[model samples]
Target: MNGVELVCPAGSLPALRAAVDNGADAVYLGFRDGTNARNFPGLNFDQRGAREGIRYAHERGAKVLLALNTYPQPQTWSRWTRAVDQAAELGVDALILADAGLMRYAARTHPGLRLHLSVQGSATSAEAIAFYREQFGIQRVVLPRVLSAQQVRRVVAQTDVEVEVFAFGSLCVMVEGRCYLSSYVTGESPNTCGACSPARAVQWSEGAAGREVRLNGVLIDVFGAHEPAGYPVLCKGRFRVEGRLGYAMEEPTSLSVLDILPELLEMGVSAIKVEGRQRSPAYVAQVTRVLRQALDACHADPAGFAPREEWVAALQRVAEGHTHTLGALERQWQ
Candidate 1:
């Protein structure tokens, strides 16, 4: 466990600056359009924003990785292509890409640009990583958050490309984010639209001593008077599984790996990515700063590493729920 880079998320220009200011080794963001993953309202960088963000990060001794992670539609190839060209021209440290055609184009057009395989491609195994590396000259691969620390070590041993794993943030339980559950119910594709349950699809109806949460005309969840209601996505619904109503996809839990950083670093992971580009700038700043401090302490003495419980607790305050799981860090958590 020599040193592990902190790869954070930046949804907007202010968030980008916050991430760098708080000690993110690298920050990944998407464009304002659907070309990037977090293509929601009031998020992502425009062309001017991206240029300034790159400049800001570089000045602060941090790198900016542009995320062109979404797959392009047949008629939308030109939009995605131009984004790749602009990201390279703006001198992003690397381009996190998923589209094969765009990767090939970048490899040819901008020969010096560094390419990283995105988890959206669902490349969990070493063979898939190798295929991208061999074909498009990918230098790093953000492995899907579906492998345990031991499995990460196996991947590291098998691939020449540097491995990056998500260590914290939203625990997306839908098979490395190959999720169509929400789109099926809400008619908005998260993969292309960057919105899971589109704001327009959700409705709250008062029920008997509770509320009925609906999505796209379907009943998602019913919250009792004492029960705290959450964002009613279909997957998080309490369904009848094995004759009992309980969470099926997963109970809403943020992934926390502050205590398992040593295992990831020992597994030879090049970087630990913190997911949540949709979060606020304050969220970005606090998480980056605390994680950096924790990583610093761990690097100083691995055995002496004691996670800052207050910081971890602060995270829960901003978290979507009270639950936190080491998503994929332990295989059973999957």
Candidate 2:
């Protein structure tokens, strides 16, 4: 199988360089503002940084995808439009967008700029994808992490656009870009604010035997002495289901598709995406390197490349539960 392009994450200029140097075919990133999805403190590029990053990645024959993927308020159209303009001015390889108006603006204003449909729009069906392709000229699409490889193959056979699927990093059990757990508690929406469970709202209260993980003062989870606590998002927690208190939506885990590279390639995907932009540069470099190596191997012998246990060990250092799953890629969902 011809393995798909390796599209990795770059939360900072240094991370961008690391991803490229470590063997990424393309790196996806965002500006510091709400224009991108992974808006976190001390992460993301400023305007100047993005320009330099584009140059840095392009010089190495790797592409840079600028994520303008957030939905805009009626009054905040200006911010979104300006970001699109800036990405075009900086000569980014593509703009990953969600809003229809923003996509139209990009196509009309920056005609030469390439358009990619972000998963925020929830373009799951072939019909939905075609709508964007016909209307806004989106050449590529970041498919939501909700399709089986078989379902993905069906979508690809039906649409004319290039498909990008997430291969590694945080698994969002809630619907992609449509979660409201943060807003219900903190008044900040991921879709509009480009943040989910904002960092400032997270708090940990120590108890005699353990700690309570709270979000905006609401107790979402309680960690026992033996249990470890993460950043305390509303989702990805142990909750009650039918009187049993355990992980309901999903457990804290990362999605790993290293073993399924050949299947994804056989299904005709265009690129593989790694999802952790909130993570460190070291995490980015290591994951990119392993996937790049796997991809290189798969191009030679499709069935011969099985991801080593060491690669999984390397990934588990940053994986949410110290475990990984094939997730929707293997149809492991309802």
Candidate 3:
């Protein structure tokens, strides 16, 4: 196996620096608006901050990919277009985008700027990827976390474009860019507003039994006295079904593909992306460090590769609900 690019998330300037300092090959981030996903309070960069981050990453031999990965309504189209211009002006290594109109504008207006299809595009098939590559000149596609490794290998075999896959962090059970559970509850979603389970609508209440988590005043989950509490995202919460209470849609767990590093490398994946821009700088640093070490180990001896116990422990310490899953990389998840 050869060296696979390690792309880390940077929700803030500090996170950007931490990723670069911790041996990330590239750092992808979003602006402080609806143009990108992970639009959370006190996170994401502004124009000036993004420019500084690009400079910082370049100085450290790391590339920065600016994410304008959200869809835009008719009224918001100009803002997304202007964001593309601003990203090019700031010297971003590439623009990660999802909207076709925005991609067309970027490709036609600034032909030299590299384009990457965000996972939000949800292009799982070679035909869909081919259309983007031909129409908008997307150089790479970030595959959604919905395919098994064998399926991913098939996609790679069918496409000439570079492929990137999520390797770690929170898992979105719903298909990227199509989830409406948050919007149904809060009138906001990642596709339009670049957020799910918006902080404003979240509420936690302690009770005699334990705790209750709610989203937009709707009861999502109730925790036992000794059970661990999690975020009130509608999908990951436990609910009543058939007179029994349990995780109905999905559980509160993160995706960790550390064990499949060799398989990804062998499949000729161009990059492995870490997906936590809403998390803190410490989280970014620790995750990047562990992934960096794992990547190095795999590249050194692919056949002998194995996940380190310490690496797993380190990631679990920061994982949501203190649990992780193989996600769709394994057939069982499908």
Best by lDDT: 3
Model 1 scores a C-alpha lDDT of 0.84
**Residue pairs clashing, model 1:** none
TM-score of each: 0.95, 0.96, 0.97
Q: Candidate 2, residues 93-185: lDDT per residue as tens digits?
A: 889998888888999998888999998878888999999989888999988888887888899999889999988999877667777888899
Better of 1 and 3 by TM-score: 3
For all candidates, the clash counts are 0, 0, 0
lDDT of 2: 0.86
Compared with the true structure, all predictions reach lDDT values of 0.84, 0.86, 0.92
For residue 292, what is the lDDT in candidate 3?
A: 97
The better candidate by TM-score, 2 or 3, is 3
CA deviation > 4 Å runs, candidate 3: none
- The stretch of ten residues in a row with the least summed lDDT in candidate 2 is 325-334
In order of TM-score, best first, we have 3, 2, 1
lDDT of 3 by residue, 150-232 (tens): 98999999999999999999998977977778899999999989999998998999877679888989988888887877778
Q: Over the full model, what C-alpha lDDT does candidate 3 score relative to the true structure?
A: 0.92
Give per-residue lDDT, candidate 1, residue 68: 90
| Best candidate, TM-score | 3
